[model samples]
Target: MSRFITIKDIARKLDISVSTVSRALRDTYDVNRETREKVLAMANALNYRPNFNATGLVNRSSHNLAVILPFVTNYYFSAVITGIQEVAYQQDYNIILHITNDSPERERAIIKNLAASNLDGLLVAISSDADACAHFQQVIDSGVPIVFFDRVPDAIKTSKVMQDDYNGAFDAVEHLIGRGYQKIAHIGGPQGLGFTRKRKKGFLDALAKHGLPVNEEWIIHSGFSREDGEADALKLLKQKKRPDAIFAANDRKAIGALMALKKSGIKIGAQMGIIGFTNDPASTIVSPTLSTIAEPAFEIGKRSCELLLKHISKRNFIPEEVILPGTLIERESTLR
Candidate 1:
């Protein structure tokens, strides 16, 4: 006899049909209690262990979901992972994490090699430079549901969850204006991202709303890094007409700007005001604490997972676009 026992062995020992033994082992309500007891007794005697792989094949479910995103070391992404794990544990599902290192090529490679049978769904946050959605479209064509969170692509029609970038940027710029600072400039993220464009529009709209002059040279687009922020700030400082205030795309950049301004012997708040999005903890740790718009990262993860699960359960579920609001935190950086 084989060392590994199967349900067929139990069925034979109990003189019952294979289907009957399967139902009894599953504890289905339709199976009679007497038959179920016999089947259980036989299974125990035969040391029968069910194979999850076989069961998954029969049920067409793996109970596994994948999350692909950039930079897990980032504060915002780490917080989002925590929220995702919470929901996965409660629902008895497993999560498979894939890091793209913020590279479009890596993102595409991961999507290309996904094993459809091993994953029921996916949660994605596209790379900053991802300009195409055909790779994502292939996944959808293969019948795997996807729910995109922050930094999502616009080409595909699917469920998405993210912060209100436009409103957050608008509020950040308006706050600077309210503090009696004019000649405001913006340091934005990569141009390929939708959220970055939205933030830029908000910055321009806010300036136009107050009839403030828009200086094209003052607006700079670059990567979302503290180094980028510092470099962009230095470039602005060198300009003949320097901005009295700046609004960075994120907190890391704002802190970078802070460092540059301090090094240049410029007063942080009085001489120049600065604000950023994403209230990272480093905002408080830095000198002259940075003001920022706080994103609901954890909530975005939880909702994204929940929405993905819904799509898994019902393939025909209509896609939803969820936009969560961000809160503005005033700190020393913006204080006049």
Candidate 2:
């Protein structure tokens, strides 16, 4: 293969030193803007690229951050990634993406195999419980800083960026109640997740504060999925004392429950009401637009990256929680 062009080539072509070419490429120092542009354009034309690994070796850094998550197709997570990308691009950092599909073993194995070094930090949004956090902790022990976003573990003493899931759930339930919804059933997320517990607490607390009897049969725990929503709604509707309203963990679930109820010719936003969290795009697309708690997913992702970058820049970075507040989106789903 033909030899790859380098800064040395640019220097030789421009009758300048290699150092000048390096600084020019970085647009640093007092290099003339025109010369810098020329060097950059030439490098692009020649397909010359800096070897990041070599730079990392020189700077004692990998210059790459990894973001680990369970799912990407979900609108909430996607928005978070968008936020991360925007911040990373601005900070001149590159990001690596990893997905575990909610498998604790897979999550552990991926972290174990990361081989460290070329990574500066980690942004983790876990799917499993704190019991499954050993794998995530392994990287931390190896000296790579981690900042979690969204679904974080309860035990890890690291900076976290997440929505106030408890408060968001509370607002959703309270809104339903405000609209005259009583006998409300809750379709919760997986029992293992931290956010799920927070959301469940919010749900139960809202009921208790209103003096509504906590019906054991009305609360169902399942995955954050449409099928789970459908199944839970069906189970509740079959009960002798069916709930007049449903509060789902996420918008997908809420939309699912709405579909199930609509299929049964049940009136939504009238005799029956449904509300959800996450503000998934499908919330508005559904027959009766869903009233949901909107998590600032992009802000969470962006803030997580910012925190991880801070830790990477300073080894002794103190950990803190960054809670992005959630908003309530009112629509037909919660109409009285």
Best by lDDT: 1
Those runs of model 1 whose alpha carbons end farther than 4 Å from true positions after fitting are: 1-55
RMSD of candidates 1 onward, in order:
4.4, 4.0
Q: lDDT tens string, model 2, 126-187?
A: 86644667777778988999998888888889999889998999999999999999898899
Give one digit per residue, the lDDT tens place, for model 1 in 49-115.
4434434633477878999999999789998998998898887688999999999999999998988
Lowest lDDT sum, 10 consecutive residues, model 2, at: 50-59
Error of 1 at 186 (Å): 0.3
| Alpha-carbon local distance difference test for all models | 0.91, 0.85
Q: Estimated TM-score per prediction?
A: 0.86, 0.86
Candidate 1 residue pairs that clash? none
